[model samples]
Target: MTDHPNSIHQFKVKLINGTEKKLSDYKGKVILIVNTATGCGFAPQLKELETLKNLFKDQDFEVLAFPSNDFGRQEPLNGVDIEEYCAVNHGVSFPMFDKVMVRGSEAHPLYHFLTKISTPRWNFHKYLVNKEGEVEDYFFPFTKPLSSKIKKKIQKLL
Candidate 1:
């Protein structure tokens, strides 16, 4: 539980396509890390996430989705299936990691850090991190991805 900004880099996560990625690769960017679910009430946020990504393409903002079934068994698809569902249904183009548990002892390292710093109340919960990899803010699942609150935060960080 180091408060070091680069501590996130020590964690590696698998991509939906079975590739491994290091958080260090996204060091100099503003990241919105979210725990997602395909059948959740906020599932449509995937589209909003895509919209945000496109709008902030020139800026240092990115959305990293981590599909999870930890809440209500919402997302049951594996990596490959989830990837296809997102791409085909929501036209999601942002990076999506492999399925992960966002809570409890088995949670991924990245999520463990996130929840430890700012606990996510439920699915679709978001952690906004600054360019230096510091946790800046936390948004609940009910908050729309493109809401003014989130948009303003992104603008301020950029």
Candidate 2:
């Protein structure tokens, strides 16, 4: 496991299926971590994220999605329901976690660590972490996942 305390690899998160995942497991890979809400107006970005995931499947890249109800209660689905909706509707192929508060007192520790770098203003906000498990940069909620800027950063990290 990574020894750096400031690194994202130090954190653990729960999957929708209740499996515990260590961020360290994603070592040496560029990761795009996003807080998503299936009901948000920007829900279309889910499809775009899936497209990006597919585009980089041959490389050491991953898109990890976390469902959040922090904004407008936009993500009403929980657990597997959230997973099914993303798959059936947006064809999301990335790993999705259980619903969690992305901001404020109840925010997950990983989100708190990330907020130390940049905070999510709304659903779909994304953090681009480099292969070393440090937050390289972040995108506003509205930034399309497959935008040239996002893709370029991912390529640069890869």
Among these predicted structures, which one has the highest TM-score?
Answer: 2
Full-model lDDT for every candidate: 0.88, 0.93
- Per-candidate Cα RMSD to the true structure, in Å, reads 1.8, 1.7
Model 1: per-residue Cα lDDT at residue 72: 91
Candidate 1 yields a Cα-based lDDT of: 0.88
Clash counts for the predictions, in order:
0, 0
What does candidate 2's lDDT look like per residue over 26-62, in tens digits?
9999999999999999999999999999999999999
Across 20-139, the per-residue lDDT of candidate 1 in tens digits comes to 898889988898999999888899999999999999989988999999999999998887888789889999999999999888999888887878777766789998888888888999
Model 2 residue 113 lDDT score = 87
* Residue 91 in candidate 2, Cα distance off native in Å: 0.4
Residues forming the 10-long window of minimal summed lDDT in candidate 1: 1-10
Decoy 2 TM-score against native: 0.96
